[model samples]
Target chain A: MTDRAPGPVRRIFTGPQRLAPHLAALSESSEYGRAIHNADPPPCDAPPWPEPHGGTPGTGLPRPDPQRSAGQALAVVRSGALTTVQDLGRYGHAHLGVPRSGALDPPALRLVNRLVGNPEGAAALETTLDGCAVRPRRAVTAAVAGAPCPVLVDGRPAPWGAPVRVPAGALLEVGRVVSGVRSYVAFGGGVAVEPVLGSRSTDLLSGLGPAPLREGTVLPLGPATGRAAPVDGVPTQAPPAELVLRIRLGPRDDWFTSAALRTLATRVYRVSAASNRIGLRTEGPPLERAVSAELPSEGMVTGAVQVPPDGRPLVFLADHPTTGGYPVVAVVAERDLPAAAQAAPGTPVRFVAVRHRSSG
Target chain B: MRALPVGDRALLVELADGEETAAFHAELLRRRAAGVLPPVREIVPAARTVLLDGLDDAASFAAGLDGWRAEAPDARVPDTVELPVRYDGPDLAEVAALWGVPAEEVARIHSAAEFRVAFCGFAPGFGYLTGLPARYAVPRRPTPRTAVPPGSVALAGPYTGVYPRSSPGGWQLIGTTDTVLWDPARVPAALLAPGTRVRFVATAAGR
Candidate 1:
């Protein structure tokens, strides 16, 4: 309720004479002053809101509008793919079947947050594949990181991976990604969505935090910090043509035969299109299970390489289920999980087994 | 006991039984309070295994687990939580018939046994408890209900549990409880955490 935006005046064109000034004001507010001014003058007379229709409590009639304060940040114009608010994650609740859902590529979130002068754990919009466009209610600085995408402000090209000052009411459009699966957008402050269970990240598996972005969803921005880290250029890795995930054999590795383990390490798998925040499903030869007997469900962690009865491996991600029944043959190192997020469908994948507890 | 590698930052410790699992879980909790396992973030206990996540040096921790001792009986027993239940459920008659006992006898048998929280899964605050004798094991509904209401006391193979939130379940419902199993406002939220002991008391009223 605190973040709700004040209602905008419903402008009705009486004649062509009044429309000229409105159109001119829009053009002038751009990076260059064409004809528009900073303030768009309000109409001389505005109609008061109608009284609420009272029939019955359950009656399908319109109720009086709650007080809506103007939002300080971005207004979603076009939410692309599957955008959701994300922070570090919700932790310490795995025993209760809660997954720690956060940004799949944490590095991208940190990079954009640094560019926008926000804290590392602040919530941001994670856009999948095709990017999103937003219009800020107040002037704010923003940066796009993660997957490479075109950054544009009111149809003018803006620098990617660097902070760009967006004037209030200007459309900041992030075009579809050139490569990779997800892109992150960080505001000057951060996404000020309400946190659920100590995290703002949306859990698709458990349905927590803010829901996935839809058109016209207004997101509040936190107050911007003055201290932004200076940077010449932040280094970014390209989307992997072939995702090579380094993993360590697991506690249930003995359940698989030697041939299966060999196949896991040697064979090339393709990233499945069904992959989402839950897990990175694969399409390849199934890893044959030596033990056909059912094992009781066990706790699953991020990056767990669990093999189902079908034999194809599924690398658990940020939104993976807390407990699973499948046997986990290996677990990808935490460091290599970011690359998994960026991997697109049909991208070749290889599992490289490393020494237990070894760093990549 | 065996400590097996899960990944670079986690290790799965397999124990002999649910009692040992509970003891090991309590030991981890005790050590975590003393700041011994500084890097360990989450310690999740299942039926016969405990997963340690976010460990700084998993290999070293696994090595140290070999010498680790299970805590005393006093330390192993977590706080016991009591739930008041009404001995009325849709499946109560079916369960009584299956056990070859009257409906009143079914309630007596369930409340007579002492229960311990073995592990938590399926939903938040939903703990699978161990205490029911093997003879009382009941088959799940051939077709699971589309929605089992929260607080529905249910029994399945080797475990008795309450549905923390409405979800599809195949477990046989024996009764219903009004006790709040999960509250987000409370510290640790889940009332039925792993290792907590539980006792169900039958109430006179159904509603």
Candidate 2:
């Protein structure tokens, strides 16, 4: 495949220029733009379209190693809790029941990838709670972002958020987070696992891509090309002390009693230990249903806050099933999900209802 | 049909039943293929609803859905997948008894019927097939098995399915097949996608 990056024309459409007209129109029609203007701006860091494996073409970034060898790999010395390979995710396959699996903290993953000079959507290791350790076969640049964790090379302290070069065969250890639930560790060329349906992300629900890391696993790395981003430590979001999720009442909101809706908007809920990649289960008063009859299985989406028989709401996550029988009371806005991912068990969660944004 | 807004980017259109869902899904696919349908990331059909997700403007799109009708699907031949099976599951006798047929007749009865995939869920490539008459519908096992081996042809309610992978299931297994239901290496991955016709051909017992 040609390694050409997307030209300037595509960049203009994706950047501020495209949104300028909308902003201008909004300013002219003040009353109509109330809802639309209040909506959060689309994340600027993400490309408008899915980036193909190897590199993000639209970013005008250089492709990682064209002549990468199998010898350029890492040996897992310590596989911490639930470490898995992740990228942006596999998309457009929910019709066949495939889950869109990817890094929970997408911006953090992108930051780490940038620090190591890899594309934003390149595959990397996502460690749960405790971090992991690996020994590179060849000296390579690596960075850790998301959930603020300590970095060590051969037991010596290393920078956490900036790219650090480790010598060949040196043990690069990612220490447990002082807080937060997950952390991302990215290498210069990114993890070079074989892609399944155009993604290297491990789907825990559908059991796709590579399995969770185990001690003694060997992961191949692509060739390093461009230089790491010239930067010191980057700023990162801290784990939420009190998780506040902005939600839009949903397609099945009518199924719930009015009292339930009030409870959802006003009550305080805690993050349950049962939460995982599938859904963020909550510990709180169950929402009373207006319609108690069973709902025939219907398509479920990421961010859907589905309430089961127990009445507690569960917010669907990246690896959620494509369909479900439970009624969805609301959907959390996508922008707030990275904070939800880092919410540790017992963290207080408050769901605030928001008016759906009108089309811009 | 009623289209309800699902968040900012999706609409769940409730249909009358499975037949209506299939027809509506077909019409949506036709419109999409013709580039007339609104931009959507996924058009997923389930039991009695079709979810149009990742819409550019869900409210307007949902408003437009009121005027839409379920068109009769074109009579083009659908893709057919033939799976060879051995009627030798541990629950074969139990299923035969439930069907009020002889043990051997169960295989013949199952092999004679044609099936069409209605929807896929539970796992990737695991299609919920609709073909058997309502009378042939069987209840799920009283208790689920800890592990139902992959390729086990099973029945539950009015649906027939083949386990794509080893998973804990409550379906009544009447036979076993060697066909690979899900292979990520294969293009499209799923051997039996929604709307694909399927036939189970009875084969000799040994591997």
Candidate 3:
């Protein structure tokens, strides 16, 4: 699992300029009939996509015994960056100090699952900045959504955001994210890792669920049910150029100075490079607090906009700690958090205070 | 008392004190169990606030907070769980010296107190108990240990807490407990959820 691809990866093109002939043979095995070799050759200076052990596409790679396609399981070949299994979240355990970890981009997860005929809450693989590659042990219907990326099965280009049936022993590589920080991948049958606290979500803060997918990790998929939704394509929101988070002022806004409150709404902040599942740290003007006293640790929820002594506001995410000592100036709306999750480092962030809308 | 808006779907109801917060939390928990408050996702109780998340309208819910009475039946009827403690800790002598008492006397005072679970945080099943008198309150260690072993009974600033799992903490350690404070395999998982009454029964140090 530790073996990593050396050097930079090659760019995979669509609508084919050139692909090695072996890709067509691999796609013929599946009834899906999706385009096979959509890759254009690398530019003269660019490095070619690495081929493992000089193995030719589809045939030369060692075929482990084919497990039945009834369940869609995949063997990890290249776990690019940080890839983890995620569902909706683990709820009803905040009092016990468990974090509610889930897909940071819920809409993306839901759409991918919908395309693959799985329930919205079904567990799926979430890949970070650089995408991951896996070889299905069995033929499976899957879709890549969220961040736009090059999708390939057995060196053959597959449609992104549409259902693609990947045959057994084919390498399904999700290329580097083009716009967003994370991507969602869903199979017909959900990733069937053992659920902890009734969820398959990997809680990075609490070290829950199966550890982040490493190169040799084999993921078990649930029994396939139903057929992929018949759709040519699904539209998705593009990663925002400026991440604007709408927030409602506060459970503890009084703790901050009037100038600090105004600064929060008016000032533009940039997303910090140190941002992770726990929080979206900002590298902007530090907010000044009116009170310097330490606040007793209290319960914190997802989307809590907590301000530390340093004054930089940290917008909590799915895997945020259940409790925090710092006062929260505001909380971002649940719907806007998905975009917050996709925000890249250095992306401009502006907090806009809006009147609380009653949806109930 | 005031109901502060936490977010669009949650409210942080500020109460007069920790007792009032616990009472309100108990009342809300009762309402949730009875299906009266259906939209409630999580009910988190801190020292002076009870955060209720996943609601339909937080403003309306907060406005209606007054009508929801804290009844006698829901008045902190805590589940008492006795924990056997070995009164041998790194900070036992220091804590005893701070209180101007012998180490055995410090253990005696800790064991005699009928502590109420104030709130659960820091780690799972780690409850901050409020039973010690104000005079007995001790400050946290100037430096925190890199890793405090699980089930370590510790004291810091008017509260006594047991470290549910091994984690870095600044609290002054005074004893150790064999009680399984947290076990995911068991139902409830946390032995000391909020409002669970706790009593430290001192055991022989080497036992």
Fraction of true contacts kept, per model?
0.45, 0.55, 0.48
Output the worst ten-in-a-row residue range by lDDT, candidate 2 chain B.
B65-74
A96-205 per-residue lDDT for model 3 (tens digits): 77778889999998899889987677789998777889988878889999988889988888899999998888889999878888889988767876566666777665
Sort order, lDDT high to low: 2, 3, 1
lDDT by residue (tens digit), candidate 2, A263-302: 9999999987667777777899999999978787789988
Q: What local distance difference test score does each model get?
A: 0.75, 0.79, 0.76
| Tens digits of per-residue lDDT for model 1, A1-360 | 000000010111111111121222221111111111111211111111121245111111122122322657578998765677887787777877677888999999888888887767677899877788999987888889898889999999997888888999999999877888788998876776655566667776555567676677788776565455566446666666799999888879989999999999999999976677888889999999889877776788999998876799989999777766678999998999999999888899999988632433
* CAPRI class of candidate 3: incorrect
| Residue pairs in candidate 2 whose N, alpha carbon or C atoms collide under 3 angstroms | A65-A223
- In the range B1-207, model 2's lDDT, one tens digit per residue, is 988878778889999989888889889888999999978988899888999899998888977887886566778988789999998888888888898989898888889999988888878888889888787888778767767888999988788899887766778888899998977666657888887899999999772
Worst-scoring 10-residue span by lDDT in model 2 chain A: A1-10
> Residue-wise lDDT of candidate 1 within B1-207, one digit each (tens)?
998888877888988988888888877877788877666767888878898888888878888877876667653345678888887989999999989999888888998888988887666677888898989988777767767887899987778899876666778899999987875545667788887888999888954
Docking class of 2: acceptable
Candidate 3: stretches off by over 4 Å: A1-72, A357-360, B73-77, B205-207
TM-score of each: 0.83, 0.87, 0.85
Which candidate, 1 or 2, has the higher DockQ? 2
